[model samples]
Structures are given as C-alpha cells and as structure tokens.
Target: MGRTTWFDDDGLKKGEWTAEEDRMLVAYINEYGLGDWRAMPKRAGLQRCGKSCRLRWLNYLRPGIKRGKFTPQEEEDIIKFHSLLGNRWAAIAKQMPNRTDNDIKNHWNSCLKKRLFRSGIDPVTHEPVVNVKATSSSTMSSPTLTPSSSTTDSSTSSARLLNRLAAGISSRKHGLDRIKNMILSEPRQAVKEDKLMISSKEDEEEEVNGCFMEIDDNLISTTSLDELLCEPYDMYQSDLGHEIDDQLDLFLEIHSLGQDLS
Candidate 1:
C-alpha cells in the first residue's frame, strides 16, 4: 500500500506545500533560472522532491495562472474544446491563456460534467444522450452514417487535418481526394507502381513507402523524403508547412484504413 510520494523516502516533505516553502522555491528560481529539477531541491534548501516542486510551481505558484470560477464564455469554450480533444488537457489549455492543464481538468471534472449532464448531453461523447439512443435504433433499422463516438472522434481529427491543408491550398475546394492528390503529388505515381511491380529489392521496398516515396530510380542512390520535401510545390506549401508530417501521417492512416488516397 506504499504510495509514490516522490519516492518511498520519508525524509522528503509530503502533503501540503507551505507559504515559506513556496516563497523559498520561488526566490531561488527567480535569482537563478530553473536550471535542473532534480538539483533544485538541495540548492533551494527545500525538503520537497523535484517532481512535487515542479508541479507546485506549474499548477499553483506559477505566475499568470488564472484562478477563481470560470466565466460562462470560458465554460462554453471548455466544452467545445473537450468535444474535440477529449482528455488532452494540455492541448485544451493551449487555446486558453493564463490557464494550466491541471486547472482545466479540475474544472471539467467539478463543473462541466454536471453541466453537460444537466443539458442531457453525454459528457464523454459530447453528443445528446437521447439522440445517441435514437441513432443506435435507426442504425439497426436502417443504415446510419454516423459512427460511434470513438470512431467519430478519429474521423473528426482526420477531417480537420484535411480541411486545414485544403484551406491552405485553396479557399474554395476541400474535397478529400483533391487534398490527398496534392499531398501525394511528391512521388505518388512511383508508390502505385511499386504495388504492381518492384524494380528494387524486397528488403528496400518498405522504406520506399513512407511519408514520401522513392522509386530507386537507376540506383543513383536512394532519394529521401527530406529531399522531396526540400523542393517547393505550391499546392502543398502553406502555413501548414511545419505540419506536413502530421498531414502525411493522417493521410497515410486513412489510406491504411482502406480508403483510396489516390
């Protein structure tokens, strides 16, 4: 029944962090930058472990950390953000300034859970509970396109990625195939050809089918996806340039799910 109180060593202080502890920890951090977590305790003359110190500073003692009851608008934003991200508190917290991941998570558990249920909405799925049951019934009676909450979430993420890339490419067009085509414009033909016939060895073929494809043309050294990415293609280039791998990964994931990403 022993707990992970920073470690089993009872020498380190546990439970609540005191005012003096907070003041000392903060003063040390201010005078000298947060150099290393493990070494901070001894340098600051604190009885607390590094992990505890770190969490305390981040969640409670951190400057600019917003406190008090969340406003109505903030509550609505949290619900919308939860629907998209689920339990990714850190991701949800990024949209919100002056808020910690721990704070957002606590608010959801204490306040939003009851609020969603009061509205007859499933807190986990963010869908109407009655509608969920109705959807389930119609799905058995006829064909319902709406998937379960889990599947819907994954599809939502993928769709967002596609839409983001498409928006970067063109304001008007966002058809799935068009975005897929532009994403695969690098070496897509060679990838399709690889499936039918292989000019390269079987061992090397797997590497050919990644974020980018290489045909192993003329054995003039295997070209990398980096090389392909280095070259500019207007359609695929945008503010989303940094997220190319993420875009590619999602595209590849959907392709693996039996969709023709060509």
Candidate 2:
C-alpha cells in the first residue's frame, strides 16, 4: 500500500484529553477569561487546537453547569416542557438547570418515548390513540338507526319493530355515549377527583381539629390554658427540632397519600 504517501507537519490536536490538559484549560479560562479560542492556545500556552479548547470550555469548564443524574421532578419537567416545545432541546435544558440538551435528547430517545407510549399517548403527537375496540364499536353502531320508520310498509308491525330497534340502539348509544364521556372527561375527571380529595381531606382535618380542640378544652379546664399555650413558645425555640418535626409530619402525610394512591 506504500503507507498512502505519508505527510508529517501537523497543527491539529488529536486524541482524548488528559488531566493536565483539563487543568491547563480550566486555569487559563479562569485566570484570563476566554479570549479568541483560535488564538487562545498560543496566548495561554496550551498545546491544543482551537476546536479542542472550545469544546473543553463549553462542555466542561462552563460555570453553573449542573452535573449528576437528574431527579424525577426534573425528568418530568423536561418531558412536559418538551411536549410543549418539541425539540427545542436547549430551551428545555435551560428550564431544567441540571440537565444538558444532549442529556435531555438522549433521555427522550431512550426513556421518555416509552413512558409516553405506556401512558396511552403518541410520543410524537402527544395525543391519546383510540383503542381498537372503541373504533370498531363506533363504526358498527353508527348505521342501524335510519332516519324514517314510516317509509317501510306494514304500519303496525313496522312500528313495533322500529320501536324495538330504536330502544336497542338507544341503549347501545347510551352505553357507548357513557364510555365516550368517560374517555373525553378523563383529564377533567382527574382534576375533579383531586379537588374532591382535597375537599374531603379538609373536612377530615376540620373534624380532627374539632376533636383536638375539645380535648384541649378539657385539659385547660383541669390545668391552665395560658401555660399550655406558652409551652409551644419554648418548644419552637430549638430551630433544628422545629424543622425536623415539620419535615417528619409532612413526610408522614405524603407517605400515607403515596401508599393510598399506589
């Protein structure tokens, strides 16, 4: 092959970055603030190409760049936002501070697409697909109900048969109508369910507090109301304890709800 007629003089930096290379780039950028990268190497005394220096600074040395695995909330936010924004990955990444566009893009391809499909939504359209059963039923049900009954002869018999047919169809329509209502109303139903739950919880809290107040009244009758009220003042003085207790109570309630929902 004659080694493809070799030529020697090189200007471009190749291969992976070493620790010393990283340190030098970081230190140079930090100390001098990035000037022209095309001229940065010669100015900063680095043995790297401009492209290499630019990539290192952008992908690694940039301040406020978040690292580590994203939390579930971040993942959800990214999905929801991208669902709205499409592939404005950089804009989506901006909203989720810890996530890069590259990371978000990868997660969308690897994970989010499956999640969307599993949730009954088309990943591309973000719309729910009608199930096969629903489609078939709708098609079959649409016919059977003709506009005129009198046009067919045998007046009495036709009337009775028409009534029966109408009833059967009305019943089927009512059932299918109910199903369609459920399908269309699911999102609203979820909102209403949440509201009802919150209302019920508030009512429960009110009842519990009323009982607690009755107990407190009895305690005050036996002891002193002023002393009991003042007890909490000294109790809240331990800032760490107050924080811990609040967190414990919140976690307990959230844990109960999570278990119930699951």
Candidate 3:
C-alpha cells in the first residue's frame, strides 16, 4: 500500500496530527461514539480525513490498546497465528487480547521476522532453513524436513495423509542408510586408513605378573577399557558382532557426515 494521504488535493489536514486534533477526535468519540468515519473528522473539529481519525482513535487513543513490548507468550501466539493464518494481521489480532492488527503486523515485520531468520527459520514458511548461511549450490547444503514433506495437501483423506507421512519418513531414512553404507562398506579400509602411529611410548607403566612389561602390558590394560564401554555410544569400540558392528559403523558414519534424520 502506498503512504496514506493525510490530504488528497482538497487541502484537508494530512500526515501527523497535533495534540489538539487528538483531543478533539477523542472528545467527539467520547460524546457521540464511533459510527460514521467519513463525517467524524468534521464533527470532531479536525482537518484530517475520517479514515485518519478512526485509525488514530482505534489504534492509539482507544482504550484497552496494548502498548510497549510484546510479552513472550504474546510473541509466541503471534508466531503460531502467522504460521497458520499467513499475513492476516486482523485475524491474528483476534487471537490476542488488546493487540491491534496494525501493532501485530508491525511487530511481526520489525522483530519476529529478524528473530526467526537469525534462528535458522524462514519467517514466511516458518520452516527450518537448510544450510542457508551458504548462498551457493556448491556449498553442500543439507536438506531440512518440513510440513511439505507429505505429498497430499490439506484436502487429502486421512488414510492418504498417513501414507504420505510414512512415505516421507521412509524416504529420508533410506537416503541416510544409503549414504551410511557407502561410507562403511569399506570398514577395514576406513579403519586401516586412520594412520594413528601409536608406539611403546604410550605403554602403561605397570608391573604385570610382577614383571615390568611394555606392549604386552599395554594390551592387557587396553582390555579393561572395554569394561567401561556401553551400547550405541561405545558401539564402535565394543564387541558388537561383525554384522551388528558394520551396521553401527554405518549409522555413525552417516551421522558424522551430517546427514539429517527426520
């Protein structure tokens, strides 16, 4: 919308109003009440348009209008409403007590939009941004799951919706598994390629069987570390069977590579 004309070639007062103007508008409304906005300015003794007078009364001079910073709960409600109702500011205002449509719209535009963006969310769609800090396609962006994951729209049947939801999750999980398998398919090579050159310098200083041994003593002490291990977290180093270990390695590889899971 273009800037609201305070005056249209008719020389009627436009733009910002004076203290006396507000006083006159408020006084007139207090006495006659709000009805005919086109005639209100004339009766209110103001040179402004009826639209201006009405807006000033309702948005500012009106009683019960919320002023100052929005509370946490109010901000949350605004976000929720925006996500569901889009940019329908008046509709969002109905959900919030004392908050006018203009105020909510202003707040969303000035504050919430920036806040959402900084938190890695697209304020318009209200979805998590996917590796968005990078501007180029070659930046290796990760995919983010969003409400659009489902194939069906809002008009879809319950069974179709459920199937789409299941399908979306399955597709994501399968993609992750494929990447994982690719990395861990050469489990031996991956382990072998990790060129960590440990030597006798790392041997534990302990008297084993009353004899101060070296590498053998280190091996004996290494076995004790396995007792400290637990499932999932320690799975890589623990004695999961060959097949289970391979799967676990695959999962960890995918996870380490930053493949998103739904």
Tell me the TM-score of each prediction against the true structure.
Answer: 0.54, 0.42, 0.51
| Winner by TM-score between candidate 2 and candidate 1 | 1
Q: Which ranges of candidate 1 are over 4 A from the true structure? A: 1-10, 131-262
Q: Candidate 2: misplaced stretches above 4 Å?
A: 1-10, 131-262
lDDT of 1 by residue, 1-262 (tens): 3333352466888777778989999999999978698889899999888998999899888789999889999888888666544565776687686889999999998989878866776564454444322233333443222112322111133223233222223212333454445445644454443221111223222322321221222111232334433433233345223434444554344344222332
What's the lDDT for all of these models? Answer: 0.53, 0.46, 0.51
Per-residue lDDT of 19 in model 2: 70
Q: Would you list the rank order by lDDT, best first? A: 1, 3, 2
Give lDDT: candidate 1, residue 24.
Answer: 96
Return the number of clashes found in candidate 1: 0
lDDT of 2 by residue, 12-81 (tens): 4565666787888888888888778888877777767788788777765677777767678877887665
* Number of the top-ranking candidate, with TM-score as the measure: 1
TM-score of 1: 0.54
Ranking by TM-score: 1, 3, 2
User: Among these predicted structures, which one has the highest lDDT?
Assistant: 1
Give the distance in Å from residue 7's predicted Cα in candidate 1 to where it truly belongs. 9.2
